[model samples]
Target: MKFIALFAGLPLLAAAAPTQRALGMPLQGDLCMPFQHDLGTPLQGGDFTAFAWFEHEPIHPPIQARGLRFWVGGEPATYCPSPPVVHCPPGKVTAFSGGGYGLSVMVPGGQRVYVSPTGELGYTQAHSAYIPPGSFLGPFEYTPGIPFGHYTFNGKGFIACPNSKEGPTTWKVFAHIPNAIVPTSDIQDCLPFQAVTEIFGSPPAAWQYT
Candidate 1:
């Protein structure tokens, strides 16, 4: 099944970048604002997409999320009152993007970064919480006060491949950042980009958002 985003009010404008300390590390594309509300979905193997504004430009092409890809392995993913899960083919399940909030960031150094309404919240361990939770976002909430920036690439970085099951699933979140060049901030607000959000995951299904 294909996924679709159902927003309520008008889109909020971008805010000044947050302090570096609150940022944790350098961010990419743009600094994303937190989702003050619940952005959830009721489908497995579907798609969710949203467009946000940046104070500057991105470093790679945005993602083109489309189509029914993977089988979340259980009931449809949900959020709001609780978190959601992005199940794999079988018992090995993980949550992709579904929480009370959303965030954006860059990788490696800073050559490229990302901004996503979908908060990729990874596995919940007894220790720290894993970001980019393992799947793509379903219902994305946008707000003002978000920051935006590009990456510089300090050294080598990680990329996701369809064959690497052990690789990080958060790649689905950053899939919209400019990976090769830079994206101008002159795109439409509600339209994600003049470009489309692309797909990232195995067989390209996990990252598929139509």
Candidate 2:
């Protein structure tokens, strides 16, 4: 699996320059580029939106089913924090616990969907599966850019990208994590993989601004 060159033939943005920003959940890491998707034929000329739906149950006592829905584009949607925080910054990405297992995108024709690599994208890291259920954590703040790598929550991992690059779009999962289990339908979109680069040190050279 090889990744399309993220910085190929692109100008790097200055570090100090203000990046174009949009309000949404903050992802765990930076975005990757040249992201490929298998959501059927591309839209002719109209804009489309992506969405992800997640569900799982906690392992602790008194387990309960939890779910979350996230959207990329369309009419403005309301995001009310579970507990209204009075001092959240203007651009803060709200964080949360309990991750999601299923993923889907709403394109022009209909919704394109995908389940977790193994089972469900879990929340905490104390699980027995490759992708722990309850792993769909975070509403962290993120600025849009070319899809990049992902972040870890308590050692559990999930790829993070802008709403546009979510669902039906994936890098080489097996290449990065050799034992990773991917659905046959998603394999077509997994090739040309790029080695995952940690964004905690520094941001990538190129990214598409919102």
Expressed as tens digits, the lDDT of each residue in 1-210 for candidate 1 is 011111123233234433222211222463233322322332223122222222232222222221122111122222211124344222111212221122111111111112222322122221223323233322232222223322111211112112123332211222223232112222111111111111112221221121
Model 2: weakest 10-residue lDDT segment is 54-63
Flag regions of model 2 displaced more than 4 Å: 1-84, 91-175, 183-188, 191-210
The deviation in Å at residue 58 for candidate 1 is 6.2
How well is each residue in 15-39 modelled by candidate 2, as lDDT tens digits?
3322122212222333222222433
Task: Estimate TM-scores for all models.
Answer: 0.19, 0.24
- Badly placed stretches (over 4 Å) of model 1 are 1-60, 67-140, 144-170, 174-210
In angstroms, give how far residue 50 of model 1 lies from its true place.
5.4
Count of clashing residue pairs in every prediction: 34, 28
| Cα RMSD, model 2 | 18.5
